[model samples]
Target: MATNLFQRFKTDISGIELPEKFTFPFYYEPHILSKIAAQELQNYLQSQTDFEHNFGLEENQKGLIIGKMFGVLVCQNKEGELGYLWAFSGKLANVNHLPYFVPTIFDMLHEDGFFRKEEEILNSINRQIEFLENSDELRTKEIQLQATKIEAATDIQNQKNKIKRLKIERDEKRNSFTNLSLSENGTSNCELVKQTLEHELSEESKRESILLKKMTKYWNFQIMNAQKEVDLFLDKINSLKEERRQKSGTLQQKLFAEYSFLNLYGERKSIGEIFDNNPPAGAGECAAPKLLHYAFNHQFKPIAMAEFWWGQSPKSEIRKHKQFYPACKSKCEPILLSHMLKGLDMYANPFQENPAEGKEIEIVYEDEILLVVNKPAEFLSVPGKIITDSVYQRVKKLYPNATGPLIVHRLDMSTSGLLLIAKNEEAYKQLQSQFIRRTIKKRYVALLDGIINKNEGVIELPLRVDLDDRPRQLVCYEHGKFAQTRWEVIAVENNKTRVHFYPITGRTHQLRVHASHELGLHTPIIGDDLYGTKSNRLHLHAECLTFMHPISKEEITIQKAAEF
Candidate 1:
């Protein structure tokens, strides 16, 4: 079959027009055909022995399945006949398996190919790295030795304390003899006691100093040498990993260059050009795109499509068994967007069009140096990359001469309520200072999606944006900023818990991440699309803002109630 084809008004093979609705490749509501396929797949999985039993039973079981993603793509033939194609993420599980699905766009597993050789070489490197890791047990033994040395040093100190006590008692006895030395015999006894005490004290001081020196000097060379060996081993492993990445990246680019992608319009784009930044690791390897590409090239009308996860979820992210997921942003977004059956109910691009249309910025309080307003949901607090209608623009219109950034603190676009705007440079500096010093107190009222066991607690999780996916943050200890939120449940409403949030240190998505992270509240805020499921609106609102007035130095408090 021809691998790639560009769009046309009508295929020479069929006179049918393309489907009217453009399918947004990434996020979509599954079609009826997809639902049926998913149900069948789920039924098949249930018959398998341990499909759902132990997957999420423990925290450690995540990402252990080595699972594969599967998809069912619906297609119509040139004669207007409809059928579905089944495909897997990378390759069929077994090489000898009977063919039940559409063949992959290209056999990624051709034994005589360059790809196979590169993969084999990469495997060899991985094996060496693993062997090195297993053989290096010196670090564990070094820790044990470190503890043993500390205990031995402690024992010597205890002995030194005992000797000091004994010396003190002898000195007291010698003093008593001195007071009673009127007789010659008493004087002789006093002299004997003093000599004994002086000899014992000198011996104890000498032993203590010698023991202390031994503690410092003993095993010093061996331990240092052992630590150096462990560090060198780790460094070698890191160096190999970098080399492996470079090798894999080169292979990825080569494969991407050879492959071409197809869209619903029947347009063609080379995978290499689709990903100008870097070709994703597994390009044209996904099930849905593979099926669609084959069908389109074979002159079949590509219809609806769906992909479902087949195994345990990763620890950091949540995924349900049999639940469908959108194409991955880092790996599959560009590919899918370039090659899905298009013209099927496309998603709107809020960035290109005005996202804040028909919205009004409500000013709560206005003064010569400040503006306080209720920021509407979906409205940016300041000018954003794509959406420019913001509270900053509104305030700028109201006070054209106002200097400094008028928008002080920003609320997430999905969040609604109180916002403070500084009108002048001096006022902005003073207010910003209060925020840096944490003198500014702000409260957010949120409704959690699930019941929260604790009534009140504090969450301190380091957070960083998932660079692989934009606008989403995760709890990453290695590279994250400190974020803290104190929460107290206010009320429970209709199987949901309403909570009060007092932020101590502000970071992007601070409250949202704290509420959803397992180490934190372990409950996502209601209607959090990024962390939780999508809903009508985000059930979070910045209800209050309190800070010392920049000029008056008086405490100011602002409050707004959340709507559901």
Candidate 2:
């Protein structure tokens, strides 16, 4: 009776809910199960030893339906839920296989009970489909409403834009009439105003142009007049200078009354006492007047004329004066005193002796190691035949016993003061090293062409000799050795500046080149010629030298004043 009922229920359920390909139960646990676990069970049956070759598991709301052999096994389980998993094995499409249970669990449920439960699952799934269809219809209506609202808003904006455009057109037409009337009135007024402005501007420009022309002409005339006045001033100054020179010439003659060699050597009265009697009445006829006249006529000579002046002297006295004809060719003269005193105030003094030549020329400082002297501007530092009668010759003559007084360094011919000489070879070597190493310090005084802007400053530049000219140097950026100098302004007078220059390097003509070329100053050292105006003289003066003493092995500093 129970088997008949089970078969009857299966026939009824199969007929009522048969799918075209498959059928599934309506159960929450089966629909929500992980797809991975369902697939794992499907794969397991395909490879198992008791499983037949034709096998398949279809996932549905009942978790999975296992179809193998000739029967199906349906399972119900949630995630993390445990259930007895059954495998059905029988003749599927006329084939047979062994039936098994997972984890060794078995179930003995009839198809009558399973069919009854499956019917309820199908009914529940039908209700969910109906609800989803109704919700989709409502969502479609909401989307259509939103689209309609957007289109209506866009049409309203277009209408507003059209109205604004029409209003603007109407306003433009209305303003055209009013604007035309105003433009007519404004045009008439503006034309009149424009004509009046143009007339005013033309008249003002004409007046300004005329005034500018007159001012330009006036300025030009003033410039020419000023130039003429300057020329006249310079002419007057030159004239006055020449007039002064003439008067000075006559005055010099009267002061330095001519010395007669005949009178000087033959007479018992000294040249000083003879001048005390009988003063000359005229400027040209003083007792010393002939001395100036003789100097004006004679060439440069160191000694007096032997036949006229020194012929009467005793042989011993002549020898004492170094007066041998061939050996002592240097000439002495009375005029030499006047020539020597040319720039001194004592030229006009009546009572002056011929400067002594016999006295040993003084060495300002001398030791076994070093010798320092006040070198005269016109004297050479080293002895040679030409200017051999120099400071060096005088030094050697004074210190005849000393060995090899080498000239460690030298000042220029026209540069004066503080010449250093080495007494021995070792001192010479040491001093030369100091010079080469740039350890010795030197200071000079210069009279510049114009007042410099700064009171004190330094000039650091590279220097190189001029390739075109032998004795000149140029500022070379590409290839040159470094040189530096420090300068301080001493005083300013009539735009002429007195400066003290300290050279850090012993470059030839470094300071003069910097002052004139690099500085664009045209500042010539009072008498410098190469970096100065053509009429200038070399006006550099060595005023100081400081270094370690060669022999004393102590610090030595020397200073002197420039000869004006």
- Where does candidate 2 stray beyond 4 Å? 1-362, 383-390, 534-537
**Per-residue lDDT for 160-246 in model 1, tens only?**
676577667767766675666655556546667667766876786677677656755655655566567677778888888888999
Error of 2 at 413 (Å): 2.0
Return the lDDT, model 2, position 123: 49
Which tens-of-lDDT digit does each residue in 400-477 have in candidate 2? 765665677877654566788877777888998998998899998877877788898888767787553334566776
Highest lDDT against the true fold, candidate:
1
Q: How far does residue 275 in candidate 2 sit from its true spot (Å)? A: 60
State the TM-score for model 1.
Answer: 0.67
Positional deviation of 10 in candidate 2, in angstroms? 99
